[model samples]
Target: MNIVRKLALSASMVALCCTAASAANLTVGFSQIGSESGWRAAETSVTKQEAEKRGVTLKFADAQQKQENQIKALRGFIAQGVDAILVAPVVATGWEEVLKEAKEAKIPVVLLDRGVDAPQDLYLTSVASDQVKEGRVAGEWLAKTVGSKDCRVVELQGTVGSTPAINRKKGFEEAIASSKNISIVRSQTGDFTRSKGKEVMEGFLKAENGGKNICAMYAHNDDMAVGAIQAIKDAGLKPGTDILVVSIDAVPDIFAAMMKGEANATVELTPNMAGPAFDALDAYLKSGKQPAKFIITESKLYTPADDPKGEYERRKGLGY
Candidate 1:
């Protein structure tokens, strides 16, 4: 080959090689919302597994359930020039500025399992379960289980002002709105924690005549339901029998509770939010295809008849 032709070909090959390497070395930063619950822990583990499967570099930061920590982590990711970012925001608002910075840096941001109140153009997409549907499913189960009987329900809600808390409560209320026989007699925020759930349930028990007047307990998440189960037992009441227990987020512990006849039903909030977020990111990065603004995950309901032991075994090893 002529020297000029050979040089041109070699340069082209080097450019191709560099492009391929860059494509293979895609780096993403993930800001997790701390290990506040078993479901959150499972999300972190699943996100890492998904990143590894895609051969992507994942830079993970735990926000410790603080918005400031999340903001700091996002800024760091932007400064590092990550190809993309995944954030399970601790709260819904106050994310516009940081997301704008990421947009200015030309880094795509995908919300995981939660969303922020930012402009649509600022984020690639949000991957989360239909939290309202989750709550509705739980409420429906309770309504069906009661079957026209007058049922007074006590609710253990998640963190106040959070998206999940708000939407889940809305969904449950919608579900039971037409059921004149069922009513939420008492509701309190459990902060999505087992300890807080227990404490809140204790107060409800005291306020509701030692749990006798409560026919059912509906928790926004399973962690709270599990905690409430202990509170029910402490109050010398049978949980699943005396007070039907229903909740969202079918974590393994809830399944265990179901197995022990402590919990009646639970709706699943799958922790594989990152899997869809990564899929959307890959499509956007590879072909410039825009995913839908919201990618809703499954909201499956489980009861004791669904073989809680099998579900527990399936999820027990997923770092939950």
Candidate 2:
């Protein structure tokens, strides 16, 4: 071959090799539930950041809060033959079939921030906070703050059948079970939205003598707590003062509320689920090491006494 032709051929071969190497880098598909709240949005942002940090190509899909949409996304990910899949399921019970498909394709699936009711063999691992523990922490904080006072607590629950809603309710109930002085006088679903939470709290206030009878409020999440705080103010009552406010998911807005003394306490559900998930995936893929089926994240509690403003500042840029 001529020298010029050989040089051109070598350059083309190098370009092709580089392209193939880039393509061979780990590619993961992430099927996220829609940004239903600030926490969810933060999770999505953090997942993308984590993928970028690890040089993994991420194929993201938003399910818009629908199980059918999530199922469809999972199928598409399977068809794409991704190296792995991460899903923060919108609900738990309807994941068996899609998960089975992933399992059959030999793709390791990880559940992020939520879990499924499917067989453990279907997914590599689930990375999430202990929902019950989160609720229990909030309840325990409320109980300790009240300190034997007869407290009539109203609960603003999450979406009715969500695993977080159910487990958090159970944990709070368990925490306050021994405290006869602390009772949940009114418990209703808020659908995990601010508007619904405000609506539900308004009803609770009207039913309980215009918020005078309620001593405190326990929301399944901070978004609901923030909404209920507004409801308390509209009803001519102070939230942190008249009715001690406590909830889970320490999103930035809740920290702002705490800074304003509108919220008393919250349990943090960190949006760093993807960090742990990617770690596990890397370990498994690199060494064939099997991770535990359930990988529980930290459930940290935050009170107003904590640096609320600092917390808010720290989480503000996370797209919350």
What TM-score does candidate 2 reach?
0.82
What is the alpha-carbon lDDT for the whole of candidate 2? 0.88
Name the lDDT value of residue 234 in candidate 1. 100
By TM-score, the best candidate is: 2
List per-candidate RMSD values in Å.
8.4, 7.4
Q: Which tens-of-lDDT digit does each residue in 93-151 have in candidate 2?
A: 98898889999999999999777788888999999899889989988888889998899
How far is 128's C-alpha from truth in model 1 (Å)?
Answer: 2.3
CA shift of 160, model 1, Å: 4.7
